[model samples]
Structures are given as structure tokens and as C-alpha cells.
Target: MTPELVRELIARGEALTLEFKGEERRQLSENDLVETVVCMANRPTQEMGYVLIGVEDDGRVTGARPRDAGGIDPLRIQALIANRTRPSLSCRVWVVELEGKPVLVIEVPRSCKDLCVRVRV
Candidate 1:
């Protein structure tokens, strides 16, 4: 997504289709990441949900930590979410530079199955 869209989402605040995770102060655990993705995917509507990392609940952009040598790996994130979530959720992952910091964005589509049963992480 574009940087402007990310900003708009943050301005709109959290909702059923949007969540913000502040990974600036404390690193977000892997389990929390997976669970958030699962929750967004399970939303009742078929609309796309977004998880914006590096953004605080109050809309502060402190930025996400680099997972690799120089940046976060989108492919790695996609694989992790797919592997951890039940029904194997597939998502689009990317990074946007805002206020001189990197924000990680995970776009989760609604689950096709009845529910994400027995999701373990």
C-alpha cells in the first residue's frame, strides 16, 4: 500500500478491519503476530484487514525493527503467517517508510473456511 494510505488508516484508528502494533519500544512476539493475523482474517466480513506494525495504538509511528540485515523480509513474514495460522492464511506483506522509519504492513484477507479451527500460533 502507499504511504498515504497507511497514514489514512492510522488516522482512522483501529477497527474490525484494522489493527496497529507498536513494535518500537518492545519487540512483538511471534505468537502475538500470528494471533493478530488470525484475528484479522477471521473478521465476519470479506473485506481486507490490515495489521500495521511500528504504529502505536494512539497513532504514533515509532517504526518496526529490521528483521534482516537491512530491513524486514516480506516473504519471511508471509511464510510465517501461513505456517502458523490454521487454514494457512495467505497475506500480502510490505514496508512503508514514514517519518523516516519503516512500518510493516500485513494485509489479511477474510478466511474462506467456516473458521480458523485449532489455530496454534
Candidate 2:
């Protein structure tokens, strides 16, 4: 996504199709990330949903934690979401640099099937 779009989304604040996850204090867990994707995919009204990581709940941009030494891996995130969801969710993951910080953006498409978390247990 473009930096302008990211700024627009942040300014709009959280809504049914938008969610902001702050990673200021701690790293955002994978489980939480997957859960957010599932939640957004389930929303029928929106054609697409956005989850912004490294932003505070109050809309402050902090920065996303790198999954490894390389940095935040969009491919890994896409695979994780696909593998963890029951019908698998196809999402576009990318990092948008804003305010000199890296914000991880996950775009979730509307799912025709009811998407649920795939738990091994």
C-alpha cells in the first residue's frame, strides 16, 4: 500500500473494516494477527479490510517488530495466515514507511466461506 493510503487509514481511525494494533510495548503475537485477519475476512460488508501493526490503539505509529534478523517478512505473514485459517485466507502483506517508521499492513479479502481459525488441538 502507498504511504498516503496508510496515512488516510490511520486518520480515519478504527472501524468495522479497519483495526490498529500497537507494538510499542511488545511484539504483536502471531495468534493475534491471525485472529484479526479472520475477524476482518468474516465481515461481509467490506470488500477489503486492513490491519495496521506498529500503530497504537489510539492511532500512534510505533513500528512493527521484525519477525527475524531480515525484518518483517510479508511472504511469511501471508503463508502463516493461509496456513492458520480453515479455508485459508489469502491476504496481501506489506510494510509502508510512514513517519520514518515501518508499519505492517495486512489486507484481507472478503471470504465467501466462513473463515475460522485452524487449531491443531
Candidate 3:
């Protein structure tokens, strides 16, 4: 995604379709990420959901360090979600440069089924 898109998302703030996750203290836990994806996928809006990493709930951009982003394997995250959730969740995982910092974006499409649940992670 472009920096402008990321800026727009931040401007919109948290809502049914958007959520923020900051890595201020430590790396995000797999379970937390999986569960959130499930929740967003199940939302009634049926619109695409976004999980913006390195952004705080208040819209502050803490941002992920370059090394931190390098350490996060998108393929590994995708595999984890695929194996942990019931009915599975298909998502696009990518990193964008926002203000010279890495921001991970997890885009979750609305589920065709009723809901997605996290079995384990």
C-alpha cells in the first residue's frame, strides 16, 4: 500500500473495518493477531478489514524498526493463520514504509461463511 493510503487509514482511525496494533513493547503475539483476524472477518459489514501494525490504538505511528520488519516472515504468519483458524482465513500480508518506518499491514477479506474462529495458534 502507498503511504497516502496508510495516512488515510490512520485518519479514519479504529472502527468496525479498521484496527490498529502497536509494537511498542514487544512483537505482536500470533494468537492475538489470529483472533483479531477472525473477529474482523466475521464482522457484519462484510467489508474488507485491515490490521495496521506499528500503529497505536490512538493513531500514533510508533512504527516497526527495519530489523523488526525483516524478522517478521509474512509467509510464516500466513501459514500460522491458515493452520490455526477454523474454515481458515485468507489474507494479504505486506509491509509498507510509513514515515521511513516499516508498518505491517494485514488485509483480511470478509468471510463468505458465517464466521471464522481461532482454533489455536
The per-model lDDT (C-alpha) reads: 0.88, 0.87, 0.80
Which 10 successive residues of model 2 have the least lDDT summed?
A: 112-121
User: Which residue runs does candidate 1 get wrong by more than 4 Å?
Assistant: none
Q: How many residue pairs clash in each candidate?
A: 0, 0, 0
- What root-mean-square deviation over C-alphas does model 3 reach? 2.3
Q: Candidate 3 on 1-121: residue-level lDDT in tens?
A: 7889989999999999999989887767778778888888887786779988899889988885333345767677777777888788778887887877778888888887655555563
**Which sections of candidate 3 miss by over 4 Å?**
65-70, 113-115
Lowest-sum lDDT 10-residue window in model 1: 112-121
TM-score head-to-head 1 vs 3, winner: 1
Q: In terms of TM-score, how similar is model 1 to the real structure?
A: 0.92
- lDDT order, best first, reads 1, 2, 3
RMSD of each: 1.5, 1.7, 2.3
- lDDT tens digits, residues 77-100, model 2? 999998888777789999999889
